[model samples]
Target: MLQIDRWKRILIIGLCVIGLAYAMPNLFYKRVEAHNDAVAAVEKAGGAATPEQEAAIALWPNWLPSSLVNLGLDLRGGAHLLAEVQVEQVYKARMDALWPELRRVLADQRSTIGAIRRVDAPDGQLRIEIENADQMSVAVQAARGLAVPVATLTGAGQDDLDVSAQGNTLTVQLSEAEKALTDDRTILQSLEIVRRRVDEVGTREPTIMRQGADRILIQVPGIGSAAELKALIGTTAQLTFNPVISTGSSADATPGIGEIILPSQEQPGLYYTLEATPVVTGEELTNAVPSTDQNGAPSVDFRFNPTGARKFGEYTSANVGQPFAIVLDNEVISAPVIRQAITTGSGQISGSMDYESANQLAVLLRAGALPAELTFLEERTIGPELGQDSIDAGRIAAAVGFVAVIFLMVASYGLFGVFASIALAVNMGLIFGILSAIGATLTLPGIAGIVLTIGMAVDANVLVFERIREELRTAKGPARAIDKGYQNAMSAIVDANITTLIIAAILFVLGSGPVKGFAVTLSIGIVTSVFTALWVTRLMTVTWFERRRPRTIEV
Candidate 1:
């Protein structure tokens, strides 16, 4: 028993020492670069740099660790937004895909389904009007298998011969299977696109996650306002080359007019014609950077591929002094009059763009564009003020708690309490070391988890002492009682700690951000505390007894 106790103490202390060494980086210098940057930015802003600013500036070392794994939005001052993806758009895409098939089906079985007419509704809604009541019923029945779980059949009015409505207003409802297919594809595509775009923007610790049904949650730390986020995700980013149509007032308005028509890829009924030929297409874009023109006005300078350059030169050379429209996603962004041919592969986009707008456009162009529009559904940001307060409060609370726990243990158990306190200190060190090693963010809730572990850390000691007391009452020798105490209490200790660990695991899986942090610390604490209390303290006690060979074991 004495030997076991001695070994346990040695292991616990050694591990704690190793942990402290590993985590020493965190204790001394955590956010050197960020602090220095903050100070520099403040100085640049013409604000008076105070002593605290100077101290922060002095504290930051270039070689030190960065400000990663810091507190979250609740601790920091930031904006939170909830944006939802437009699911109806996914449905529309599916319908557009089925357009050719539907047309084919209708032509084959003309008697089965009635004449089909496409109708455009408000807010991008499309409807397929089914003509003739009896024929419509036949068509609806025929389309049942295509779009499963069709809604209740709507009857045509007595006077009205046209089929008023069916499920989805297309004489067929989209099946659960169809919706699932469309939803999955849309979400998967949107997520990937959003991630790529955000990553390009270079926001620190950006979080773009999918939510319920058709929603995406985006969280960008240190980016307080989401005006930038909105600009990035809200755009469908559909880039196309379109010719400018002449207003017929002047020859310059012709913009190298052309008459080529391109059919819409997504929609059969939709077709676009270029009144003037595009000098260059977005596909040729290589890079775009925000820069100031000769007049010091903000603009986006873009470079194109060799093919685009050749085409641009040809188009401009043929039609000098004509206005060429720079179209983006079907909207004319700029209509610059061509003074000369741009033979080089580079072009400048000058519009009514302010400095910020120009910079944002440059960022977007650089990041590439999303294939589809993504609506944000949920967001949460940690505020810097809240984070600082949490850190201060957590530090104080932990300090006071540790001191109280130490006093209580020593006061209650005398010599045994001293042993427990040593083990407790080691437990704290191990937890911190592990957290630092894993680069775990210490949240406010996580601090609470650590405090909770403090109380529970003494549990094993309580059990051992009680068992020793019982053994003493039974007239067992000092060494014999100590051995029996550990032997008897081992089963109870394992069962109780294991149950707590299980609960912690469940909490981690089910809970959200902060909750998960709390669960993590709590779970880790339970394991470390058990190890320290059961082994470290026991070993120390055994070593002391074996060395001193005291005849009397003080209760």
Candidate 2:
């Protein structure tokens, strides 16, 4: 009477086998990691592997699961940085872009508004002085016409630009609501760019997320140091091609309104004055790759999208025999003369860069530039040796807890306790297996969760065993007692586990970093423990009782 269906038994056994199979790779973490990395490299290289890669790939069987639970920064030892984004830069850039259009609108009504010139203001404000003081209203109206509704939900129907007039001067600045919306977008964009930059290097499990209003927290495992990580992402890499006004050797040279002076990268102290508005910016770039120029020197080739191509083509066609400055982060990389029109939408940037620099530049370009510059608020580098020590400590803690639980279960429940111990072992395997399958990262707190789970995994078994003792005292046969014991304990096991699981889910949803890691392990452990207790241990007990036909059992 106390029997599992054949299909259910097969399912349970199949799951355990699969769990073991997946968990096996973690035992040889380095070998399996090498194998996985090599495989990925070969795939990325279009099925070509070097001798070293081939050997690494052969370290593990091809048919088995090679995925391992990722180690978090605390366990893998890497770089940690808290950076505050210079979000005001975006506001300044936005105001700069709006200037040309605003000037054009006022220029169209020159007869009424009179001559207008841009006046210097704060970083994010645009101010213009008009010749006709009586026409200040007209200038303000023209500037306000350029205003667009904010795109954010909370700022719906609000104008992005706040325009006002004092005397003959008109001022335009971003509204408070729009500033808030821009801040959010800027931070989100910065986060994504940082993530892309990190992912380009193929590091494992980097924790990159927003920390607060204008900050991002970056934790990258396997990177050499915080400085290395910062260097990889710190460069704004803002590339632009602007029409050059003139070349000079003065570092403090003044430029006309709407123009900027940038130092040349190749020739120190040499500068180039260029138009503020770029012919084409890096945002329109579709692809970039490391390449070689006609002289066989390292360079980067880039292609632009349709809009960018049209703008670039028109600019080059009109500016033949003139030079355009290729600027990166406000520094002139090159000021090359345009001999002929370039309409192919593709161009090359060649400078005093080697292949390594060219390749890094290409990677950065492909990943896109950060929306705003970041100021590092804090930085730290963790060593691999420390991570190993933490791993060792966690292993000892889990093993000690596991052994104690086994000893208590076996001593208290006799043969039934052995079944529980076996189930507990299976439960641990299943947790790791699920973690590997899901590609979750394991942190120090996650290890503590696993240790806690080792103690809790036996609770359901204890309840069932106690209920069996009660049933046996009522004079029920072994089979009937075992069946009633499981049935009576099922509700309590489900209730307790479900409540704990709800808490785990809440923690996972609301918590960050280590808390989420703990919740992840605990949640996985709860499910596996429940399954092993109600089904796995019961199956073992029913099989033993059937084989032995025990007339009576002792608790």
Candidate 3:
């Protein structure tokens, strides 16, 4: 241990230098953050950033280590929302979507099954009464043909649709396995939409994640309020293209089956009678952007995917001169007359929107529709003042803890204790350095974890030092004693730190929010502390001893 290998010494010094270099940016946190934001803005603006943003970017040099640890919501202050996704809404949509395909399939065999009429059923259930009652078995068989096998691990070979025949009617609904799949998809889609909307607002480090089976947890750091966040993500943005039957002042004008009346969003009191099934939905949209029409008015230009383009083109070519409604959330936003078939797969929507609303609609369309509406179950806004208070308190506690630990170590072990103290400081620098590199969020509980780390960093040093004292009684030279001490205490040091690390890993896996924050800091600190205590202090001690050639050392 006294005569260390050349590569091991280089590794120890290299790690220490890297740690301090990465930790240097945190000393000027605000300046570094401003620089990062400016760089991001410049990149987003196609390299044409404002003069002020350019000046901000110049505050920090590009060649240096620029990474900083991410601050958690409690540290930076922002909005938090707990939302439950209404998965049942997707069920109703699925049933509505299923009707069109079911109709087309059964209509192919109209001679055999006669006529098929939709009957009233529950929200997710589809019931069809066969005009020829004796041919109900044929209708059921045809509906069952629509059932496709699910591809999920647990849902393998499970039918997507459950079709049953009862008397003269056939019932069709999603199977239990299919509902589970739908719920999973709905929650995941909701999480992605919330993330996209929050990211579009340019907020820093937003945590948009799925909470439970059908819920989402959104925490945006450095945002204004929960209401602002809600405004960003609340819109369902369910845009649909429906075939219009007729337009009238009264909603009761169209009494055809599978037809309903909806009030126009643009023109109040005017209603449109549209088919229950839409020609195409927003799900088919590949891209949407805010652009100007030929008249230079703000409009949303959209492009459809191949499948949607084919469907829309077919509908348009067959129904030229007929009006179709661009419905948004069950309200007719626009009823335009189809002049020519748009085989190009791109179209523009001109409406009563200003630039801002048009831009918002473009963003919503680009982000795609939420699978289900999110009902806000809980909301809260964290103020920046409170975050500052937390910072101040944590600063004081960490400083006091560091100073107290340093004093106690120096008083007990003299020069050897001072070596341990230096290792302790290096341990902290490395922890923050790792956190910054990984972009881990530091919460209030994380600060506590740091303080806890400060206290525990000396455990290995204490064990080794005591062992040195025991070895000094048996060994002839102080150098021999020191080498024996490290080897003897190695098992105990590894056991204690590894056990703590196991607990930290468990917390990280099973915990959420603040608990996760604690786990992250604790886990980082353990690895750094062990490295600093063993290699760092040992390196410092052996170098001093070799340089001075101390025959009898106090340590």
Candidate 4:
């Protein structure tokens, strides 16, 4: 009996030593530079972060935010938004792509229909009119090539059309029927546009994802104010370059219909003539860098690729000294006079702006273009106070649970129960060490996992004690009873824990965000509990028995 108890004691002590050693890495991990920098920065910002806190930050999960593990919005207070991308513009683009085909189809049957005039519907549909109902029927056959199957078909026949209009007011019913609402091309194009627009306001780590149908969900933490985001996203960035016309010229002439004129070859006038055709478009520039001009003034230096450079060089050579306007999203950012031919494919854009404005303009130009305009449907922000309150409540609950479990074990198993309590404490230390090693954030639910582990830690001891009682009643000697108890209890311990572990795994796989956090902590706690209970507690009990052999075991 003493021999078997000695062996169990040795085994438990060895595991404890190894566990402590395995956890040693977390001690040094507390000193990583990123952890130090974050702590120092927080202190410099007038935040009261103690050394103990700085150490805790290092142990947080790598996947979680660097800040403290906060409760979800349900536990803590936060804002929520349901943002959706406007897909009407997608329909508009589709209509534009089909416009050319429509024009060709109408022109091909112009003679048969006897002159046809088409009006564009606001919802991006075409309404065709001819001489009479007979002519309309003929034109409809020609337009069939350009017409797509209407998902939401309405109205009766040609006289009572699906799309109706009176005088100039037109109404077309839009629906999501059997028709394909959006295609892969339109979705990709929309995503790119949203990305560009969101980046324009210099948002930090915005999570933009495509949702069901035609919706996008954007999540930005630590960003409370969303008015600026709304402004940047809602506005359509439509850019156009029009030539500067002479004041003396016809005021009745349209913007782009003016005569193509250039500045004089060798004269500097207050108002030099300009060309109706743009010399170069902004799309040609591959990159824009914020730099200082030769005069030390803030300027944006833009560079073009091989194809764009050749076209830019040709345009500059043809229009030397001509004033060209630099337009951005329809607003003229600058109008630099072509003083000299820029054949090098590189040019500087100098606007009457300060350094901040120049930098922003350069950033926008570099970010590329958006295919469609984005509309902000929702915005949310959470205060740090709410997160702190959650932490406090969770701490209280965990502390109470810890004390209750410790007292329960000690009362239930007497001396062996006391050792179980110690093992329980060590088990918790190992869990934190493991959590710290793996960089897992400890949320409120994670605290619950730890508390539950404290209670579960005594499960093996209960099984061992009940087996020992059964063995003694069956006429086994002290040593034999102890060995048989441990052997018999192992299966039950494994079975119960394995079932719980499986449940935790399922919760982790199926849950999201906070639920997943709870599952992770629960899973880790289960493994830690089994180790401390089956091995650590058993070893301590065996060691005590070897030293002080009791006569008839007292339950």
Candidate 5:
């Protein structure tokens, strides 16, 4: 180990330089973070960077990597929320939607099932009573014909809807297979929408994940409280194009068989009777972005997929001069008469929107509608002062641990102990460098892992140095003793590190939140300590031996 090759020397020095380069950003943490945030903001707006932000970014060179360590919620003081998606709401919605389709289909064959009437039913069931008793079989067969295959791995080959008939009354509900598919969609869509809404605020390292069948876990670092998060994701933005049947202020205005009355969201006491079946929904949108309308007012520009575009174009051409209500979450956003057909797939939404509200609406539309409303099951707030207290405590613990380890190592083996202490310091720098590079979140538990690492980092050096002393007692020369010490201790060092690595991997896979964070720092520290001990310290000693050629060494 004392005999170092020229290639190994270059490699070791190069790694040290690279590690320091990455670690340098954390020293100027606030400045680098502001620069990154400004860059992200400018890119999001599709605008040029301001002079101030550009100057801040220029403080750090462009050639060097810019990633910094991401602080966890406990460190940064942010919002935490556990929201449960009301999947049952989607079931009722599905049934309500089925009423119109069932009415239309059974109406086409009016002679068979005469005077079909929707009666009272349970939450997720559609109950239709036919005037003709013997036509129950005919109604069941028609409803069953509307069934489609479930589109999930577990639900494939099963019908999406179940239809049953008894004593002239027909009942329809989602099959078990359809409920499974709907639950999956609800949770996944909720997760994505929550993530998009948080990201639009330009916050960093927000954790949004699915917890169970209908629950989502959201932890956003740097936001003030759970109420702010709720406000961000509260809007549904479920836009639709429904043909207008009538306009009135009467909230109780009963409608025709194919019509429903809904009040406008912005306008109080204004009701609109619109066709139950929509021309298209927000789901068909391919893109939506904040923009300026022709009148220079803030608006949202949207583009539809090919299918939606085709349907919209045909509908507009067939029903020229007719009014269509632009509904959002069962409320009318606008109802304008169609003067001419819009052949293009793209259009803009203008409703006296200010810049901020327009941008928020655009983000919600881009994220797509959540499958169902979410109930806030849990909420929390972490103050920055509390985070600072924890940080200060952690720093004190680390400093005391470092000093104790350094003093003990120096007292034990003099020059060799000093060498080990130097390697240990470099080992820590490497750990920070790796964590920054991987964008790992640093929590309080993570700090404890690093302190633990400081205590354990010198084990390899200790084993090697003790073996060197044993060799010296056997009458071997200093150079030969050092070489023998490193070679003989290699097996124990490798075995110990490998075993620890296996445990860290298990913790990372099985544990949650802070536990995973601890595993990350511990794993990174182990790899770095092994490199510093086996290569870095050995290189230092070999260079010293080559230059001084000492006849007798204290180590």
Candidate 6:
């Protein structure tokens, strides 16, 4: 009567084999990691590997599962950075773009509004004074016409700009709702750009997320230091091509309103005045790669999207023989004269850069520019030695807990406890196997979760063993007692584990960072523990009883 079906026994054995197989790589972490890295390098190098790389690859078989549970920042040591994004910079850029449209709308009534002049205002505000005082209403109305509905959920039906007029001066600024939306968008974009930049460098399991209103938290494991991480992402790399107005050696030379002065990269102290509006910006770039120019000099070759190509073609065709400045982060890299129209949509950027610089520039361009500047507020570098110590501590704690649980289970339940202990081991293997398959990161808190699971894993076995003892006291044979014991304990086991699993899910949904890691491990442990207790231990017990055909059993 107490027996596992042929298919069910096969399924249980199959799962145990698969789980242990997947978990095998963690036993040889360094060798497996090196093999993985070498494989990646070989693929990156187009299936060509050096002698050392080939040796590393040969260390592990390609047919076996090589996935390992990624180590979290706390367990691997790395760079941590807290940066505040300068979101207001985007507001100034928005206002600058709005100026031309607002000016044109007001100019339609130039006869009434008279002379219009832009006045200096705060960074995020646009203020203009008109000569005709009585016609201020017309200017205000025209400026308000440029206001559009905010596109965010909370700011629905709200206008993006708040326009007000005092005397002959009309002032315009972003609405409060729009500002909030913009801040959210700015942080999201900044997060994405930072992720792309970090991913380009091939770091493992970097934690890049929004911290607050305008802050980002970045934790990259295996990086050298915080300064090195900062260096990789700090550059704004804002590239724009603007029509050059004039060239001058004086830094203080004023270039009228709507034009900017930037120093040349090659010629020290030499500056070029360029139009404020660019013909094409880096945002329109579709692709960029390092290449050699006509003179065999290092350069970055770039291709533009259709819209950018059209704008570039028209600008070059109309301004033939005119110089256009290639500006990067407000500094002019070069001001080359356009000898002919460039309708091909591709161009090269050449300056005082070598191949390394060109390659770095190409990477940055391909990743796109940061939406705004970032000011680092806090930075810390964690050493790998500390991470290794934490890892060792976790391992010891888990092993101690595991051994203590095994000892108690065996002493209390006798032979039944041995079955439970074996199931517990299988439960751990399943936990790690699932983690490796899903590529979850293991943190210190995750280790804590696993240790806690080791203690909890025996609960079902205890219940089943106690029930078997009760059945044996009622004079039931070993087979009936075993079957009834498992059946009677099923409800309690499911009830307890289900409630804990719900809590784990809630923790995962509401928490972040280490809390999330703990929740993930705990959740996986619960599922695997339940399976091993209900199916694995029961199968082993049934097989033993069937083979022995014992008339009575000691608990």
Which candidate tops lDDT?
Answer: 2
Q: How well is each residue in 119-229 modelled by candidate 5, as lDDT tens digits?
A: 777878988888897878888889988999988888878999999988978899999999988888888878888888888777888888887778888888889888988
In model 5, the runs with Cα more than 4 Å from the true position are 41-47, 97-115, 151-153, 252-259, 293-296
RMSD to the true structure for each prediction, in A, is 9.7, 0.9, 1.7, 9.6, 2.4, 1.6
Model 5: how far residue 379 lies from native, Å:
1.4
lDDT leaderboard ranking: 2, 6, 3, 5, 1, 4
Which regions in candidate 6 have their CA more than 4 angstroms from the true location? none
Per-residue CA lDDT of model 1 for 287-350, tens digit only, reads: 8889988789898899877887788778888878877666666555666678987788788876
TM-score of each: 0.66, 0.99, 0.96, 0.59, 0.93, 0.96
Worst 10 residues of 1 by lDDT: 155-164
lDDT for each of the candidates? 0.67, 0.93, 0.91, 0.60, 0.87, 0.92
What is the lDDT, from 0 to 100, of the residue 321 in candidate 4? Answer: 76
Q: Better model by TM-score, 3 or 5? A: 3
Expressed as tens digits, the lDDT of each residue in 24-118 for candidate 4 is 54444434434645565676659877777666556544443232222344334433344555656655545544455655776777676566455
Candidate 3: residue pairs that collide: none
Q: Count the backbone clashes (under 3 Å) in each candidate.
A: 20, 0, 0, 5, 0, 0
Error of 1 at 520 (Å): 1.7
Candidate 6, TM-score vs. the true structure?
0.96
| Runs in model 3 lying further than 4 Å from the true structure | 251-256
RMSD of 1: 9.7
Instruction: Estimate, for each residue in 256-308, the C-alpha lDDT of model 6 and write its tens digit.
Output: 77778899999998999888878899999999999999999999999999999
